[model samples]
Target chain A: MANLSIRSVSKSYGAVSVLDDVSVEVEEGSFVVLLGPSGCGKSTLLHAIAGLNPIDSGTIVIGDRNVTNLPARERDVAMVFQSYALYPTMSVAENIAFPLKMRGLDRKTSDEKVVAVAKLLQIEPLLGRKPRELSGGQRQRVAIGRALVRDPRLFLFDEPLSNLDAALRTELRAEIKRLHQSIRRTMVYVTHDQTEALTLADKIVVLKAGRIEQIGTPLSLYDDPDNAFVAGFIGTPRMNFLRATVADGGKTLHAGEASVDISHLATRLEAGRNVMLGIRPEHLDEKQGVTLSLAVDVTERLGSTSYVHGMLPSGETVVAERREDQPRFGETITLRFLPARTRIFDAQGMRIR
Target chain B: MATAASDPTRHFFQPIIVCLTVASVALTLFVIWISLHDLSLMRAGREKFVGLDNYLRFFGDPRAMAALWRTVLFTTLATVVEIALGLAVVLFLDRDFAMKRLVRTLLLVPIIMTPVVVGLTWRFLFDPATGMANYLLSLAGLSQVDWLGSPQLALYSVLIADIWQWTPFVILLVMAALESAPTDPLNAARVDGAREWQVAWYVLLPMLRRALAIVALIRAIDSIKAFDLFYIMTRGGPALSTETLNYYGYIAAFTNFDISYALAIAIILTIFTNVALLTMYSVLFPKSGER
Candidate 1:
């Protein structure tokens, strides 16, 4: 295993830039996840690291070697594609042994390695079957086996579990995490699924529009986001943003008719300036710091917790988590949140620190 | 078990089925009946029932056996050469180049030309004295060679004409297959540490196996029945060197006017072609359970 360092990487296709001044650091034996929505260049950055796609400007160093100009095979990297592209005509055993065969490995050793990989993946029964005969989950296991058998310095996964069903995706997601922990190989995974990123990654690199938004641990990004985008993108039910204006000599914030006291943050607040108040759904409780009345519109009871989605008097939507009580629709409910839990952002969506 | 009375779609298909059965089965039976009779165009009214006499005569006829052997040789050579050359050309043209569209359009010229036209053109080019082949030989300071005049070279000259006209047809179909194939496996192969040549040989070619087999099947059937070129270029040749079974059948019917023998020969060629093609088809496309 080797640590990978991407320094000031950038790529473009004709007039459109796909990866713009992006850089990431992956520690040895750590799982680094590139998380972003579709077309956000997370996959492009992963491909650039794999040397599958050349970057316009960057120096990618794996361990101590600069692999910027090296081809994919020469860089000693193995990639699992989103489509699970197993060679269709080859049996599962042959597919797993292909890289070894290409490197001129002898048949006896190659067969032994293929058997070992098949056993590790729990696909021993599927070794003689062609790719078309297997299910999607089985095919993905074969693909992973192919990559794993090579034991390359780095493993790149380009949304490998996205094509499976929801239950299979979860199963394989856990299997991948367990595999990484046992093998201790440096892996870079790319996906748009926040839950996958949160559960699997040692560090998450959040990207937006071809640029890195925040690079931090999963909890670090969840608990303290760098901007409104990160704060909203990282959590379920999304973080509610209320447009508010500073009033009363920077001591209070007002949105429509509802107002909250911000005397603790008055030093950073400027009077008569527009700001956004960001609050997580779980932060608002029945018994807490500051009370705010909401007109309940709907309540979703998910066994242990219920999410109360309501409209504020200020004409903003807010979702609050309730552990026991379920509020009636069209009724006004009072929910409170600690003032410290509320994140303040400027009009441009950047955090105010 | 839906009956025709209950299935409305069968009403539309019944007439087509009847027509096909009548056209194919009736004509074939008529040919078989004629093959069993001793009929000659010179004495058409006095035809006699000969049973299997014509079929038994074929076993002892050295000329007919040699013609049959020639047909087998020509079909195997043309089909194998065309497929190999076509696949190579398609792989070479798989890349991008400036004028690729123009080159592809130019390649279609030979495929669209009539077989008669291709035959006549190649005949002119193979002419011994004033032909382009001999002229080029002279330019290279090589001795003039008889392309279609010698007993040994006449069949091969016709084979070259057949390859020229049909290889593009193979190229066109294989190119279409190549374009439609998913590129993910090829890229996966590259990342699996395969070199460029290995990528094509191990991944790309195997993916294209079905298309190549289909094209080979078509070329084989056409080569077995190849007649227009041999008729136009050589007419059974300087020493009957280019007399394929199909061409010999034509000579028997039209030249010697032995109508029943020619029908018998045609029936034998048909049976031979069907057995050969069926074996080839089964080998290429095995049962679904087998690899």
Candidate 2:
């Protein structure tokens, strides 16, 4: 296993800069996920790491050697692409054995390794079949097998499971986790799905507009985001933000007709200062306490849990999970927010007290 | 009335058509009657019902057999040269470049020019003493060549001129196929660690096989019955070196007044063309069930 270090990488096409001064360190035997929306430079970063695209300025170090100028073959990195990139002309066995042949391994050893990887991915029966004959999940397995046969220093996956259906995606997600546990190799995965990044990564790098917004463990980013963008991007239903004014010696945040107690907050707060308060939907409860009255607009019940999408007194939309499915449309109910579960951000989107 | 209205085949030959058909039949019969008035002359006034004697005489003639062989040789050489040049031009223009649009438009100059005009132009350029081709060669101290004088070199010279004029037809079609090829597989090849040459050879060329087959079919069919260029340039002169079947038919019917022999040769050429076309179709559209 080798740690991959990217130092000050930048890329541009003509005048449009795609990746600017991006740097990250992927520890050995760890899963590093680059997460972002489309056109946000996540795939470009993965391509740069795989040596498919040349960066304007950067040093890409795989273990001890700097592979900044080396071609993809010399870098000893295998990539699983979004479309699974299995050679249509070759059978699964030949596709898996391609990298081994490229590395000058003998025929016998290459076949043995191909067999081993096919078995690991449970695609042994598909060895003789072409990619077109297989289903999407099967194609994905062959793509991963092609990467595994090389046993390279680092493995790169660019949305390898994006083409699979939701059910198949879950199945392959668990399979990949188990594979990582068994092989314990350094892998850099790039995806726009936050769930994939949260579940599969040892360290998640959230990006926006070609810049790294936050990099941390999943729970850390979930519990404590650095800015409004990170807080909004990291969670499932997305963190709810409300415009509020600090008042009463900074002990209260008044938003429309409701006020939230922030007296126990350790960070400095000033009166009359404008700020944004964020709370996750799961943290909202129906118990009577300091409450914000909201008019229920719709409740989407997903058997055992329901999401009450409603408007708060401030006219801002908020989503709250109803554990017992008790809320109905047109009902105005007061939803309680725990003091410790709230996060505050200044007008500039930076987190504040 | 209902039975007559429900008959589906009623429109097959609605009348006013039957009267016209009878008139056409009578006219064709009268023309055939006048044309066959001197049919005995085709058999040297020997007897009626010649029974394939004209065809037999054509097969027995050394000049006819030589013309047949020369036609095959020219077609083969011209088709091969045309396909190779077309494939080269296609591969070159497939990529994006500064002057690609301009070059593509310019390449159409040769293909769009009338074939007869192109042939006449090349004939003038290949003239022995005053031609530009010989002028350039003389400047290099090479002997001036009689491009259409020698029976051996005349066919080859015509083949060169035809290749120059028609290779662009193949290039335009093949270039379109190459440009729209899926980018996913190519990128996958690179990420799978393939060299650029390998990607071009294994992935790209195989993907272009269907287009290449079409180009070959078109060029071959056009080359087999090539007449206008050959007739305009040499008129089967310099000892009948470039006398293809089309030109041979023209000579036998018009020049030698052997209409029966000409019709027999035309029928034989038709059979050859039909077989070639069938073979080409089967080769291009094999029942692989890809659809």
Candidate 3:
């Protein structure tokens, strides 16, 4: 396995920049996820790592080699495309064994490796079938088999499970994580799905408008995001941000009529300073010290837990998880925020620390 | 997209199709009947039923045999050269450029021109003494070569004219296929360690197989029935060297006053074309049931 290092990479199409000055380093044998919305250039970064896309002025290094000028075939990398880009005319075994054949491997060895990869992917039964005859999940297995058979320095996956159904996506997502754990290869996966990033990545490089927003571990990004974008992008049900003004010598937060005790904050606060108080849904419970009354707008029941989307006394919307009860719509529900769970950001969307 | 109703016999034919079918069937049956007799327009009403004599005469005639072989050679050469040259041009123009649209529009000029007009223009260009071809040869310090006058070079001259006109047709269709082909597979091949040439030879060209086959089929059929160019440029040539099956049949009826024999050749050419096309279709598409 090899570490992928990208330095000051920038790419543009005519007037529009697809990837701005971006730099990220992925540790060897670690799963690095590039997460972003559409048009955010996460796929571009993944392509650059695989040498499928050329950077404008950046250097790409894989292991100890500077692969910035190398073609994709010489880069010692294999990629699984978003559409599972299987060779449609080839049988499953041939598709999986293409890289080995291209490298001039003999028939007996290639066949052995193909059989091994097929068994590893649980696709041995589909060895003789064409890609067109396989389902999306099976096609994806063939794609992954193709990449895994090469024993390359790095493996890049560009949303390989996005085309599958919801059930298949979850199954394949978990299987990919398991495969990563077993093989311990340096893999860079790109996806817009936050759950996939949180579950599959050891480190997620959140991107926005072709720039890196934050790069941290899954829990670190979810618990301590660097900006309002990362704070909002991570986690299900999203985090709520309320505009609050520091008061009482930075001891309290005044957001309209809603007040919060901010004395336990990690960052020193000054009086009259404006900041955004970020709170996750699960952190807002019914039995915390600092209590606030909110008018329920809607309650989304997700079986074991219910999300009470409501407006605080300050007229700002907040989402709180009701573990033991589901609040009725249009009714006032009392929710509490733990002071330690609150993250504060300044007006420019940067973390308050 | 039109499907017949549950009753298998009803076709729901449009009036135009109904008229076309009746005309085609009647003409075909009349042609077959005429091929069995000596129905000469110059000697009307003195005709006698000849049965299989005309067919036997056509097979045994040396001129007819040479014409058939010449047709096959010209058709094979014209179709293969047009496709190969057109593919090269398409590959050259596949990338984006400032004047690409104008260039593509200009390519349609050759295909849109009438074959008779194209043939006439080439006839002038092939004129031995005052042709542009000879002028270029003289400028290059080479002797003025007879383009159409020499029997050896006459067929190839017509073949060149045909290639110049129809290669653009192939280019237009193949270029469209190249444009519409998904680029993801190509990129995937490269990322999977395939070189550029390998990618095209192994993946890209195979994807264009059906389109190329259809174009070859069309060009082959067109070349087999090509008579206007031969009539306009050479009129069966200085030594009948450029005479193809279609033109020879025309000459048989119009020049030799052998109507029955000409019809026999026509019938034979039709059967030959159908069987050849069917064979080609099966060969090109071995697993068509999957598609």
- Poorest 10 consecutive residues by lDDT, candidate 1 chain B: B282-291
lDDT of model 3 at position A293: 82
- Model 2, B1-291: lDDT tens digits are 788767877777556678789898887565334333335345666534456666677689787777777766776677678777887777666667899889889889998899889999999999997888899999999998999888878988898899888888778887888887776667666666678777777677767778877787777778878888888899988888888887898898888776666766666666777787788778776757431
The residue pairs that clash in candidate 3, if any, are none
> Candidate 1 lDDT, tens digit per residue, A289-310?
6778899999999999999999
| CAPRI grade, predicted model 3 | medium
A best-first ranking of the candidates according to their lDDT comes to 1, 3, 2
Cα lDDT for residue A151, candidate 3: 98
Model 1 stretches astray by more than 4 angstroms = A248-251, A261-267, B1-8, B96-103, B127-143, B289-291
Quote model 2's TM-score.
0.87
DockQ values per model: 0.63, 0.42, 0.76
**TM (B chain), model 2:** 0.81
For model 2, the local distance difference test gives 0.83
Each candidate's lDDT (Cα)? 0.91, 0.83, 0.90
TM-score of each: 0.93, 0.87, 0.96
Error of 3 at A109 (Å): 0.9
Q: How many collisions between residues are there in candidate 3? A: 0
Model 1: per-residue Cα lDDT at residue B114: 86
* Number of the candidate with higher DockQ, 2 or 3: 3
User: Which candidate wins on TM-score?
Assistant: 3
